[model samples]
Target: MEASFTKVKGGALVLKGEKKKKHKKTKKRDRSGERDGEGGKKLKKNLEHEDMNKHGGWWQTTNLAHIVGPVALQFYNGAYMKALDNGKFVLGAPHDEGQGPEPEEILMAMKVGDGKFSLKSGFDKYLRLDKAARMVGVSDAVGAMEMFDPVWEDGKMAVLGPNGRFMSVDDEDFVVFDQDKVGPAQIIRIRSNREREDMKKTEIPEELRGNLYQVETKFVKKFQKFQDHKLRLNPNGVAELVEAKRGGNLHETLLDRREKMKSDRMCK
Candidate 1:
């Protein structure tokens, strides 16, 4: 498909056009501390509080192995899903230099369960630099330690973009890339003084006073692909028959495959 933009909001994203099928724009906020671990409004509310405190990034300075050993005991006791979500999030951190790992090369590993029969590191799987490369069209079989940095330990979180490019509005300079054309994209960092002042007009409800990370980083490559063909007169949206790169022969491709699948199954 063509390039499409994915908009990341507090907890989810809002996509455009065809791929925008089920994009979620905002999150339902909740208040009140959680007690009995459960789902629904109360749990959501408690998680919101924790989220505000956590702010998405939750890499701890303490030894991960030690934390995993003890926390497993109270898996359900006083456990909050919000913390778990933050704790379980995936991020790509580079390997520090000589002493630690190369900033952009090292892989971080975190265990999920607790001691005595708990799960191993959280992101041990995506450590395959080869696999990560394939996902982003890279050819070199670089080791996980050589290629892309995984933000969320490894497998804890799922995001809609490639590594290294995405950044939150809170970054030091907060440069945003606004796609000017298909082949070329423009970086729009530093808003004007008036725009900065106008930002006050964007009032969030009292409940959503915590996050803006998820909303900002949604513009990465993955989302960009979706944005390309996401409507608004790209002209590339024209339906046509094209040859498959993997197989031989050209076949007619339907634009809305979702509807086509539904119709084929006669689920109407």
Candidate 2:
């Protein structure tokens, strides 16, 4: 056996041994960008798209500031191939064989083209604003009437009508497609049933809070705090986008009357 000896700095006897090698630190790989089994497709990074795919199923809106709140875009009396009436589409959960939004009222809005949407109603009919832009009629044909241009502004969604105007509810609570001016009635809130259950009172903006005109007083306490959010759905009935916008001030009848009085006096 061969013996090895070493000397310390102080001249003290010390033994020499083999030096051990240092191993490099292993790095962790990021799997977020990894592709899934779905045809080697990578996951999307857009949060809105993800939210829309999660909660963008059946949606309804209640015009919190102007007309009725939670008014469903449903069919008339759950009939097939029937038109929608704003007066009949009041805010409430649909029941079996009752005056509420039925399966026919439940709609699936999908993006067919760039900024263009197509709506399928519960009645298995396509939604159309009619050639005259006066009614939300249904059509079996996929023509210009069935195509809608959805516009989002200030958190409110508006479906473009045939006349290039937005679909809005009138003061009479009737669904009308002849709103040239953008008002509270023109703002349609899109939300799912789960969203409505989870809706809180603080979601709505203070500026939009007050009282609902041409509606019951109970709705003020009932829906004032209920926040309306938009959900985007994927082709597989998943929500890919979810967002909330603070609606503007309420459209008050007193304010309109005051403005009318002022205009009348100014005419003198």
Candidate 3:
């Protein structure tokens, strides 16, 4: 018989030209409970998978402090550090300019210390500094050579490899950590899935929702009742309300203040 090869679903090559014997069909077993349990497990697995991929887009990190989680290091020329299937890294352009990095360019960054981190590539290899001072993604685990320190200065970020040198791209577009000082080539933008710091500042708490005096005034307007739609604020400073809030009696304090103003309908 002639032998042939066939490619399987998972990129595996298998030998063909074999005749297999069929087995006799037996009575089906009642495995409904087992099937339901397996279905539930698959649903849970799918939910977790969705959650992991939810935070996919990228935002630039202003400082080294925000360089954790899934990240991509882009050089000044708009090229991202992409890992190849051969366990090598190169500067590759993104499919979309501002959308985000491709899977091969995204790295899972884990903070190991105050300023140290370990980056894992899509190939399931940890990026490390080889003995030749070249950046490679061949390590299966995070070792000393896998630890990297991020440096932020003058609004630019640079990475320090395990060899205590700054990482820069060479003329061949290969990553090397041999530079003693940071320059245009060494200036990298570490982008991640984290929200921008300025955006986070826009989120205000419920109690502290508006301007200090405006919040109290709005409460007075809501509770105060008179023939005219007028707001009567106490001449007393907001120090009492601020203090009462710390003591968890802000509502009572506001009512008392409104009552003192003789404007609260409940006080009548």
Please list the Cα RMSD from the true structure of every candidate, rounded to 1 decimal place. 26.5, 30.4, 20.0
Query: Candidate 3, residues 1-268: lDDT per residue as tens digits?
Result: 0011122346645469766544453223336667878999998656634533542456666655676778988888777898878877888864443356778888988888666889998888899877768789988887788998877654557788878788888777778898877777888888787665544556554654676488788787776677776767888888987898789887788878878788445466
Compute the lDDT for candidate 1. Answer: 0.25
Order candidates by TM-score, high to low.
3, 2, 1
The alpha-carbon root-mean-square deviation between model 3 and the true structure, to one decimal in Å, is: 20.0
lDDT of each: 0.25, 0.43, 0.74
lDDT of model 1 at residue 118? 20
lDDT of 1 by residue, 185-234 (tens): 21111101111221235775442233222211221212223324542222
Residue 145 deviation, candidate 3, in Å?
0.7
Ranked by lDDT, the better of candidates 2 and 3 is: 3
Per-residue lDDT of 214 in model 2: 20
Model 2, position 203, has a per-residue lDDT of: 75
lDDT of 2 by residue, 130-185 (tens): 44454453567566666766565444466676467776654554455776666554
| Poorest lDDT segment (10 consecutive residues) of candidate 3 | 1-10
Of the two candidates 1 and 3, the one with more favorable lDDT, higher being better, is 3
Cα-based RMSD of candidate 1: 26.5
